[model samples]
Target: MINITFKVTVGLLATFGCYILFQNKLIANNVFAGQTEEINQNNNEVSEQTNGESEIDVVNFNRPISPNPVHVPGWYFVPGFITQPMKEYNVHLKNDFQITAKVGLNNTASSGFGGNYFSWFVSSDGVNWDKVSQNKHSRDTIDTSVLTDSSDTEGVRYYQAYSEVQPQVFNKPIYSEIATVHFIKGDVNATEIKVNTSKDYLVSNPNFDQYISASAITQPKGATGRVIWSSSDTNLATVDPYTGKITANPNRKTGTVKINAEIINPRYMRNSNVFGYKELQVKKMLEIDGETNFQNTVLFRLNPDFDLSKSKIEWFQKLDNQVHKFTNISDQIISKEIKLQDNNSEIYAVITPLDIDDKPLPNNATESNHVKIQVKDMPPGANRNVHIRQSLSNISIYGNSENIGVHQLLKHKITFNDDSETYGYNDDNVDGNLRIPISINETNIKIESIPSGYVPDYRIENDGLHQDIIFENFPIKRHFGFDLIVSTRVDKIIDSSFDYNPVYKYRTLFNTDETVIGKPVHAEFSTNTIEINPKDINFGEHSKLEKDDVNREQDLDNEKFVDIRDKRIKYSPISLFVSSSGFQRKGAPVRNVPITLANYDENGIEISPKGNYFEVASSMNNSPLKSVFWNRKQGLKLKFNKLNFPDGDYHTTLYWTLEDSINSQTK
Candidate 1:
């Protein structure tokens, strides 16, 4: 058969071989052959075993399983079981029984069936097992494309997958661990201080030597350095440069003091520092009462002990509404008084320190108080009289009685004198006094006499005289009346005298009975007649005619006058003898009758020659009539009839004439 058969068979075998070849070709074409087949088959056997183990009663087995069923060891059942090497089996078996495991082909018995593998199982009881994966395994390299599904089974221990299972090994499990980190902190330091001053000082220049300390903690990277100060900062104090101490000027203004401190780093951080303050002190000055009165020693003063060396002082006064420098008074004492003029009305004073230009010193200046003084009447007695006088003898007139007719004329005179003794008089007599009087005295007086046949029958009328006198006369055909007047003390009289006579010649005849007749007849016959020897007469100082002279002149001449003329005779017849008739009556005386013889011769008788004849004739008397009379006298008198004569001059005349009968003519 081999040959025939080989032929046939061979042919057939060839055909079969061909067929086998074709079939091999077909099988090779249709399925993996050889190692692929063996791989497949090993894979199928692993699947079967795994399936069989999955079907095994895990309750009946005695091994324990993990509580988390979905979690499983990743490196498990990586090789076929029956074909696994003993070491691999032992390794897998030991890991399955223990809690921790390492798996590889050299340690497990089934490792040669492929590489190495381990079992992953599910169990409800510790002794029973249900295969989750079997004998096909991979290493620990993660597969990004593989996913786990626990949905179909409950109480699943592990989620797992198989590696390409020609031989098997498994991967190991991983665990987590713990870690730690670190940081740091910061700090700060700060401080403050205070100081005091004395009352005597005006300003404090605290030197840097006197210091007040300050301290505090600060932030680590915070500000740290020397502090600076100003009047503006917030939380720090100012320090003196010389003393290195902190103090305020007493005159320092009240307000906030700002301070600042900063660390000198490339980066700067500023810390604000400040403090607030006020000054403590008592201030003073002055006012004056009466500045004008403070002359000489007056003064004002501050406290006596005040030190002028450390301070300056000056003074001034206000005058004329302006301030004037007191050049006179300047000293350390705060008080002074100005020496004022006596007439000054107002003044004021003020004081200040020399060092300070604007500040006034305390209790330094004042004003003073004023006074006023008043001004006292002038004498009444001292004056002398004037006197005047007049006289009255400077005016008068006189005349004879006959040629001036029976009227005669007289005269008057006047004069004046003064008797007052005083220059002026206060009395009625014009005597001595301051007051004088008015005087009236006689200045003149005058007189006029009336004619012989006319009388001035005068009487005193408004008489200013103590007495009055008057003169009167009749018409005697020849004489006028005479009067006399005088003024003296009450009854004194003054006398004057004058004589009077007729200017015509005339004669008068009177009978024995003193009858005036025409004329005397015979020259030898007796008659009465008067004779005036002078035609006129002046009776010098003798005022009266003697009675003997008047009678002697009248008896010298006396005469009688008669008329004898014609006679006739006739014859008578009766013849009687008449011769003897008267014889008896005159017998003795008539004895001689001589005429008888003449008669006898009657017719023719011539015989009478020796005898004379008888005859008759006329006669006259021739002599001047003489008379004497007073005319006027001197004195004061009044004429009531002539009172209206206006106190001036007047005159009148009176006359008488005689006629002769025998001659039929006037004489």
Candidate 2:
């Protein structure tokens, strides 16, 4: 007689000491932190606690309900619990999943009848049945060929087996647990991972984009590729998990960061870890920024990526819409003095980017955005396409006044513009004072007049050394200056044998080369005969809005300029008179702007000589003669009242004369 024993499933709860034990099935022997629950499978109330998002169902059968209970007889049966292993993942049915029924054959059991062999049964629904395989070998464990079809692709499937023997009335089959297991198209796990970067290296700057991409090889027909990216040091750089794009911290000067990418589908292989990594060089991009400060300088700054000692910089200036090459300033130096022509123009910088090791980057050079340096309210004479041509004349005269600034011979005027109020006037603490150094190389000369708001300070004197009449608290604010009559007198009987001419030189805030700041240029004044050269003052194109003041470059083509040639004498000589008739349009009776000519050298005397004359300059001498000259820049500057005239070419005549000393005549 043949004998048969039973195979037990693992960890099955025994309701009446007859249920089976199953692995991966809910088990909470000792009360844990989670909420406790009772297992009741008959009512379909079963709970499985796990870390994964999904759980598989294990079928438990009632021993009393089944006519063919889960048992094999060796003429008798022993009650026990059976437990079987279960998987948490969606068990792939397309792959090999063997449903083997294990039964032990007793060598000699005299107790008689036993189950013959094992037969396998399958089910689409849990309640239905279909016998798909039979165990032909009488030997012990039998394998069932459980081939999955497309219909079994979703949900759990049921597989079970029962052993048969000669006269097998007591040998009944108990279904194997839930689909021995459900079907998946194929293995969906990622086998390997590959990552790629857009560029070989990275330039670390917040403004530029850093990019990387990844792909995973999932061999399953229906499986989609997945990618998970990470950065070794998130403080320095970070990579997106799905997109693999990177963003670096701007404050990080220079550093290396490792990028990692991996992908694995939990459905097929939870323990399979496939990944790839690439070491990227984070280099710094060179950058620059520029601004124009109140000190009239363009300051350039560089990013901290380069060694300033080795990385030099060059500056360029754009004037009149044309780019021009500028001086290449030394590295580590930032400030550049702005020129007069730099008003309303663009300035930019180009630097060759370098690494900390003093090596140039792959892209050597970079340029900063064009910094438009707009120097506002630039002096009328301090810009291109328009000018206020004026200069200080060399003073040559014979005088015997006691004080210096109070005399006519050494008199100088520093006139403020008509629009001086446009700029704010601050106190001495804010806007500093103006210092004028009067270096007289001769002797027996005294300062005659020190204008009220300004006085000489810090007078330094040494044997045969220079002198400075410093104006300590001149009280003039920024862009606020007035016609300062700087007058001084000379002794009547001191060194008349040599030439005598003292020039009051004060370098204005703007450059003296481009604009005549101190004196009218290119004129030789002779102390002999009298003459005058008045150039045709062609105030260039003017819009109606430009009613401020003198803002035009004169016509240089006119071979005419005004000259006052006065022969030096000790007082009481003659008086020079000036007058002008209002200009009228050529061949038309319509009048133009009324003339409000200001003669600054003569105490800032402004006259609107409609039809009369005004005495402008005089000395104590009864006889006066020759080679003293004046141009628009030297002694004559015109400032008109509010302009309310029509546009037209206008002409006017200016009259000047020197009164005769003996016959009371005028020249």
Candidate 3:
């Protein structure tokens, strides 16, 4: 949620009088007015009884609960009377109400307040306080007629008072009640029908995208009445009839507009101020946008609409406590050494508009929108993501799927912004088609699926030494599925850091004309080795051959051909070779009628027979994935007369050798 807080006005008592107040033992005053002599004599005893605050940590100590007002005779405003919880007032321009704190003297010899010090303080938000009024010789009244509030729109304010007597009489300082005041615009209860309206306003959004909010605070707080609004010049600005919001005319470059709001209540008497008009100055709104780089180093920029020579920019940073402003730490907008307490802090800019002559504009300045950022503080180009990973539910068809490690899948959610806006990794994204141009870089990866918009078609084609996936027409939406294929540098097991050899490569493109190198997409992989089944081959029996059979061929079923499961996730150049010994008839001596022996590769292609061995189907560099090597005809073959050799379930053992990693030589 993005929230904006405007300026607030404060009262003199709250801002100039609120300060440190020490809580000590309360001193009861002498009820008898004639005990002035005895009271003076007991001053030492009173001072000794109330000096316990010396041991207390005043700033951090728990504030004593606001005691219910004691109506006892001499406690006067010991709770220092500012205002009560039920008090309400109006400060139209400035009300003449005098806020005073009366301290009832303790039972001392003197009946009158002679020697004492008094201080008053005020606060808008309860947590922060400011001193507003102070005096010696026991003066305690605050004339609010000259005081203005922190905000012209907000009416609530808080006040507290501290008082102490001199000459060691009743050594304890007096504490005041936290006074709450709800102010209506003017003395509406005493006037005729008058609506709450400010005296001046600045309409900064020249495009009229922003509105001037009219505050509806009435005389009686939540008074049941409707307000009607009007503008003096339609070309300069217009007011919403029902909402009372004022919008500047976008067509008009510069001008002054007057806004009038009328309250229809007829109970109060009429006055000239009842129809007071609010003046608005039309100007361009200054805006600031912020973005983070690689989750570190926040970058901020002002919109180009701003005229730098005539306007000055000031930057402010607010944590939970609004303490630091960027301009205070450094004059330059960019400060690498600025401190950020956490990711929750927000930074914003206040632009003071100046005229052609370099003088400030009257009644108005624009405040830019604020942003929150997370700074990892890494230099640049560092990918701190633990792994390329995602979690998807259910299963579907495999366009190009494998049992890859779970962490290898990159489930991406990208948001496109206008070319003018800057964005960093993992920043908040809204719906747009062409923001930052991003390309889908797939390293043996695939586009599994997506939630919305377009996902680049991860098209694979061979390019030089490594394979690359080209992201064609890839303008991404919110969420898209990018998957991976098993392509390793070599047939070796890898874990932890998977920056080893990669058989395929991928990257992003910017509008076809520009390109920026993206962060490394790394993953962790488990070691998988080539495996083969140790099963025997069986050829069905064939009938005896006649003289004419010597010219005919024979068919043999090598039941259960060579089976291999290439568990290796990465590609390694390897091939399976084969050889066979002569066929041996059980009870008869070994004989040969020219037997043809064979072993198949994963694709069932017979290994090419060299003097004794054959080369089976090779690898996936040319094809895709073929893991086994063996054919159904991988058994002894004969084309001779029955007289040449007797066929009594003759069999031969075919020898197989595997060079699982032929390209690299070993294994």
Best by lDDT: 2
lDDT of 2 by residue, 1-667 (tens): 1111111000001011222222221121110011111122342433342212244354443211222122211111311113222211234443333332333222122125543444455565545677663342234332222222223355655555444433444334332333234355443544544444533344444333333222222223223224466888775667666435555554434467777877545544657766777666654443324444334655554434333333335666675557886665645335666554455666565554344355654354444335466554454443211112223333653332221221234433444332222222211211223433333423333333224544445353534434444443333333433455544443232222222222232223332222223333222222233444434555566665566555226423322344444423333466667666766767787555664555543233444442456555565544443333444443445565667766666667766655645433233
List, residue by residue over 331-353, the lDDT tens digit for candidate 3. Answer: 22443332323345556665554
Query: What is the Cα-based TM-score of model 3?
Result: 0.22
Task: Name the candidate, 2 or 3, with the larger TM-score value.
Answer: 3
**In candidate 1, what residue range of length 10 has the lowest lDDT sum?**
7-16
Task: Order the candidates by lDDT, highest first.
Answer: 2, 3, 1
- The model with the greatest TM-score is 3
**Ranked by TM-score, top first:** 3, 2, 1
Local distance difference test values of all predictions, in order? 0.20, 0.40, 0.38
In order of appearance, the predictions have TM-scores of: 0.14, 0.21, 0.22
lDDT preference between candidates 1 and 2, better one: 2
